[model samples]
Target: MAESQDELSYSLKREAEKKGFQPVGIARITKSKRIKLRTDALERWIEAGHHADMNWMKAPARIEAEKLLYGVKSVLVVGLNYFTIPENKKPNQLLIGRYAQGNDYHKVIEKRLKEIGKWLQTKRPDSKWKICVDSKPLLEKAWAEEAGLGWIGKNSNLINSKQGSWMVLGNLLSTEELIPDKPSESLCGKCQKCIEACPTKAIVEPFVIDSRKCIAYHNIENRNKDIPIEIQKAMGLWIAGCDICQEICPWNQQKIPISLDPDTQPKEWILDLTAKQAKEWDDKNWQKKLKGSSLKRIKPWMWRRNANYILKNNKFNSSK
Candidate 1:
């Protein structure tokens, strides 16, 4: 007879895959021991000053992650593809990572997770469940790596041999026990493209990134009145997020592209806006052009700041 637990887990994975999540895996939250180790790593990483200006990276609130899956016997992880087929869209003309070009990923992932949770309830009526996306302090990438969906790469982003790190990850921790999957081994091998491609050299060393110097960190997290002059010239007009590391990663070349939810696709105006045109953009037009999009993080003023920065820096190349 097929084990009831195994059957239910298989069903859960199938449901998630049908919903267009590229990869799905199950693992137990019975990993309290790993929690302590992660905390140690977190403390050490912070002490080494790699986290940079993101003070929240060292927040005490992360203690909850130690027990995020407590009383839960399984975690169902889902990975969704978010890549756009176009290569290097209007480069140096101001860019946001494909992930941030659409609606906020937290909302997108949570919508699908709720459906999975409801389906689980139908299957395991007595079980309790909690869901989370990147919004939480949980060591989600570590858990995903342990669940066999992928390996943690040298750039500190998770990688699947077939698909790369351009996907969003989500998980549901449940009281229902399920068959657990094994962890994946590193597939980065000797590759270091992501490290060499970083404009800010944020990947200070293998598997270690210095967030303070990262372009993504600056464009998204920083509200400083004056960005570091050197960094400002190098910002290259990235208003929201950066994808240089992932773009240079070899794995992105291996996979067949997948369909994305239409509503989450970027508007045409995103690529059409130029450094010169963006400076004249009004708030109302921006609101409509970027409706429901993640660029809302780069508020009108911030986007203008980025556009102006790009215009100023690119002026040196006008003769070309």
Candidate 2:
């Protein structure tokens, strides 16, 4: 029974596949009619001040799962693969997380999401919808979980059983009915590697991260002064974002080449620069190599700031 056999959601899934949404699953976001524990988890995280300087993540948070896609009867959850070559993983070689190796995913994923929304509208002319790609403060991991995209691993990133944690999530919130997918179970069972591997102990509890100690939080969100000295050194080779927890997870062991989505390819400039060269990197080089990049969010001075710490630890030695 299609929500509108006259308008196949399954066909929408297929079209999304051709357009490069590797996995497309629909999860309805119905009104809860009652305020629930969604607020409890959010309140707990805020009360503990785990969000750190990102006070914005505190207000207007969702947890009950359906509230995110509110007023929308169905959510089309999508994932885009963004993994790249291993050689590009070296710290001295101008490293970056696999996702940010190309243009910002927010732009890339949103474009494709709107295309799906467009197709749905064509099938059902009266459909109403919106495309979201982290642009809104939705707890994407929760949405992903509900849509069977993956489990929010101990690292706090969505880890697909097949693709590891190397994908960005996108969604189409619609005011049309569709069956919701079941959430994935935690395959991480008893494996505490990601929690243990966080250099700053950011994973204070299972699936609960304290951003104050998270390198990714400090590097991108905490925009004042030099990062705390205690964690600055622990921040280590994470020039922009820290992938330490994901890297150490057993789930990421199955490495595969991402065949689609230009968003996954590694850039040459980011792959070949020696730490010394990256240090001497001029304004022109920064713009050319990292423009429209997530790195741009970190003030230019912050790059020089965080990179200098990694440099001193290696004792000015480009190879350590």
Which candidate leads the pack in TM-score?
A: 1
Q: lDDT tens string, model 2, 120-175?
A: 88877887888877757666666777778888787778889888888888888888
TM-score against native, each model: 0.89, 0.89
Give the whole-model CA lDDT for all candidates, comma-separated: 0.76, 0.73
Clashing pairs in 1: none
| lDDT value for model 1 | 0.76
Error of 2 at 254 (Å): 2.2
List the lowest-lDDT window of 10 residues for candidate 1.
61-70
- Per-residue lDDT value at 302 in model 1: 68
Q: Which pairs clash in the backbone of model 2?
A: none
